[model samples]
Target chain A: MSSRDAILARIRAAVADAPEPPPVTRDYRTAHVDDDHAAVVDLLAENLADYRARVHRCTEAELPALLARLLTDHGSRSVAVPPGLPTAWLAAAEGAEQHLDDPEQPLTARQLDAIDSVVTGCRIAIAETGTLVLDAGPGQGRRALTLVPDHHVCVVGSADQVVASLPQAVPLLDATRPLTWISGPSATSDIELDRVEGVHGPRTLEVVLVG
Target chain B: MSGTYLGMPAFPQAAKAATRDTRLRANLRHATHTIRDKRARAVGELDDWAVLREAGKRIKDRTLRHLDTYLLQLEEHVTAAGGTVHWAADAAEANRIVADLVQATGETEVVKVKSMATQEIGLNEALAAEGITAYETDLAELIVQLGDDLPSHILVPAIHRNRGEIRDIFAEKMARWGRPAPEGLTDRPADLAEAARLHLREKFLRAKVGVSGANFMIAETGTLVVVESEGNGRMCLTLPETLISVVGIEKVLPTWQDLEVFLQLLPRSSTAERMNPYTTMWTGTSEGDGPRDFHLVLLDNGRTDTLADEVGRQVLRCIRCSACLNVCPVYERAGGHAYGSPYPGPIGAVLTPQLRGTTSAVDASLPFASSLCGACYEVCPVAIDIPEVLVHLREQVAGQPGHRAERAAMQAATWLFEHPAALAAAERAASATRALHPRRLPLGPAKAWTETRDLPQLPAESFRSWWQHHHTEPPTPPEPTS
Candidate 1:
């Protein structure tokens, strides 16, 4: 028999006498924080900031200027833009060059690294954990875009994109799509268990919350 | 598995040298204590941690009970999703399959995400033997690989090394790999991380093949999850043309929804974060996205044997959170290398002996390494009764051959205890020779035990004899109070 079949058979025989597993009881709270929507968004901002991600709150009209100013502040010479990102987001940043993500002619890793920053919109944001989920959906391009760049300026819609907890966020996501959940900038506690951010992923994550 | 642990002594012998190293002891004590307090606070923040832990345990139990069905389902779905699946019964077969897959790609080098399964099977050594160079991208793993050291902790492999030592390793060894460390690298953690980032970035971009092990394999949708902090996992899982994930069969979760429970438990219990910095999940292959060619190697290497034992089966539920290691007193002192495997601490004590059977002296001694403090069980995210499993494994080890002398002594003591007169006489004889008794034994197993510990002084006389002298006759019964 093939190793697959043999291994399956062994598992079967091993569990032959095992009793049925007890039913799972999920009595845990779905959302650990208050039910108020504004409170949830506030909590999200607070938690995100706590993890050292620069959190910004602005209106849709204010987003373009904020993104531009952030680029200027970080002195990004060029920015990588996802295919579906609104062009206005980069309108104010006249000095920075913009590179769009194209499926047929994708930017190479080296090229992406050379780019000063990546600006993408997230699918959802979890308030309790201060997490942003990118499904490589409309605004968030493939995994490499956010990863290869040194700085990431993610635009999250506060009204529709924010959720209270992981349980609430999990259902909203499509499992079939590749998901990148980012709580903070790429960080590592590998050296003497002290957390030091700015690793292989974006060294700086600037999340812009637009309502 | 790897030559790394070959010719290693038993736990006691290994622990002897480790315990004497005051620097190692301090490093472990500081790291474990820091994480332990943080984990407690993290768990305390949630009101229903117990409920979540139970749910996690039950989900894993349900998956393991019907593992055959789930694994087959996983194979079918993964195949349907534009990926190939291979099954290996042991380490050698798994290594061969990976080597052949990498060879087929015509790639001489592969960038790897830190994976416990690959480490368990010694995949790096296997690849190296086949003339394939595997680069470890995780910072701690890089420290271990560069320093030619074994991983001491599951989460932080280089937990044994302080910042100064890490800086030295990077400065001395980074050039041998690819990029040399910047001139005069300091001992700052940030500087060390930057050095690793600069060193590994080139490899991530140029590598055609990526090797990984998933934290969870959702059989329902055939999606694999790699939970990590650094973007190294992202670089490997995405940028490479070909991706190979060798995961243990026990890592399978029945559905994507099952991740809800574990996703919460793992991050909090592990890094004490509400959520890890990055958690990447992909179902097989995707167009215009991650790796085009994907291979999933389902490894059985002693998992089926572990499952056959009812009391031992619960260990398979471990999520590799490393919480048990942080809370374990024995692990805090003896350090990770003494365990002599990639897995260390309380989980290693129960797991290594089962995975690699108790036939070897090192494996046999692992069961007795713990003090049965139950601290490991208290902090376990899945609530694995680690203490119970340790005792069960101890019984298994003691029953095996080469324990005749210890077993005989136990039986002799039991017999003497059963006979009061003989026990008293033996105690009296011991008391009589108290003046001649040495502080430490000079030879045999007793000597090994007494080498570091002083033998207790014998009493002047047996307690039974003292009681007899105090009251020659039985005292009259006092009036009963109703």
Candidate 2:
């Protein structure tokens, strides 16, 4: 028999005497934050900053100026623009060369590595854990778009795209689509258990919460 | 559990030497205490922590019992999503599969994410034998691989090394691997981390094969989850052209929604973070993103055997969080190396013996390494009664051929207790001879148990005699005042 068959047979014989496990009792709260959207977004911002991620709150009309200033401040000459991103998001940031991602001709890993910053809209922002979930949806080009680059300027819609907890976020995401749940800029605690931010992923994560 | 751990001394011998190394003890003490306090504070933030833990435990139990069904489902979904699936009955088979896959890609070098499953199987060594060099990218894993050291802790394999030691290792050994450390490398954590970033960035950009282990696998959708703080995981999972994940079958969750419970339980119980920096979830392969070629190897080295034991099967409920290890008094002192497996501490005590079996000296000695303080059980998110399993394993070990003396003593005591007259006479005789009792046992076999602890002092009189003397007649009941 094949290894798969053999393994399944072993599992069957082992669990023969075991009873079926009862359905899990998921009494845990689905949402930890209050229902107020503004408060939830505030919690999200607080958590994002707590993890050492730079937080920028701006109105829709002010997002372009904020993105432009952030790029200039970071000395980024080139920025990766994922497909379907609002053109207005980077209209004001004309100084930086924009490389728009084409799914038909996606940039190679080396090419992506050379880019200085990536600006994209996230599918949702989680408050409880201070996480951003990018599913390669419209504006979120691909898993590697936000990765590989040194800086990430994510635009999260505070009005509709913020969640209070993991339970609230998981159901909203499509498992079939690749998902990247980023809580902060890359970090490591492997040395004396001290957290040192910035590693292989984007070293700087600047989240712009726009209403 | 793998070749690297072959011929390891039993827990008692290894732990004996570890305790003598004051430096090792200090490192373990500092690392474990810091994480333990942080974990408690993180878990305290959620009022429904108990419920979340309960849900996590149940999800794993349910998944394990119906693992075959879910495995079939996962295979179908993965195949449908443009990925290939392989099955391995043991570590050797798993290693062979991975080696063959990497060779088929015609790549001599591969990058690795820190995975307990791969560590348990010793994948890097196995690949080396096949003329392949696997690069470990996680900062802690890189430290262990560079120093030619076995991982001592699960979450932070280099937990035994302080900042100064890690800095020295990197400065001395990094050049031989790829890029050399910076000229003026210091012991500062931020500096060390930055040095690693510059060193590994070159490998990530040019790598063609990336091997990893998943934190959780969603059976319904065939999505694999890798929870990590560093972006090494992202680099490995995304940058490579051929991505291979060698995951233990037990890591599979029944449904995607089941992720909610474990996602909450793991981060809080582990590194004590509200959430890790990155949690990458991928199902099979995306058309233009990640690796176009994806492979999932489901490993069942001794998990099936572990599942056969009703009392010990709960060890499978572990999410590799390392919370039990952080809270364990024995782990705090004995250190992780003494466990003699990739897994260490309270979970290792029960898990190693079951997965590897009690045939080896180290495996047999593992069950007796704990003090049964129940601290591991109290902090276990999955509610594994580690102390209970330890005693159960001790019973099994005692039934082995070498423990005839202990079994004989237990049988004699059992008989003496069954006969009331004989028991009373024996107790009185022991009380009378209490003055002659030695503070420590002279028997060599029992000395290990008594060395760290003092044998209890026998009372002057047995409780039976005291009860007779104090209550010869039943005391009259007091009248009700009302």
Q: Which candidate is the best by TM-score?
A: 1
Candidate 2 residue-wise lDDT, A18-107, digit = tens? 998989998899888778888888999999999999999989999899999999999999999999998988999988999988988888
Choose the strongest candidate by lDDT.
1
Q: What are the DockQ scores of the candidates, in order?
A: 0.85, 0.84
Model 2: CAPRI class: high
The residue pairs found clashing in candidate 2 are: none
Clashing pairs in 1: none
Predicted candidate 1 versus true structure: per-residue lDDT over A17-71, tens digit per residue: 9999998777888989888999999999999998999999999999888998999
Evaluate candidate 1 and give its CAPRI docking class based on DockQ: high
Tens-digit per-residue lDDT, B140-214, candidate 1: 999999999899999999999999889999999999999999998999889889999999989998999999999
* TM-scores for the candidates: 0.95, 0.94
Give residue A197's error in model 2 in angstroms: 1.6
Fraction of true contacts retained by every candidate, in order, equals 0.86, 0.88
Residues B1-482 of candidate 2 have per-residue lDDT tens digits of: 23388899988778878887888889989998889889989999999998988898898899889989999999999998999999999999999999999999999999999999998998888999999999999999898888888888899999999999999999999999999999999999989999999999999889999999999988889899999999999999988999999998988988888988888989989889999999999998998889989999999999999999999999999999999888888888888999999999999999999999999989988998888999999989899989999999999999898867668878988999899899999999989999998787887767765664568999999999999899998998999899
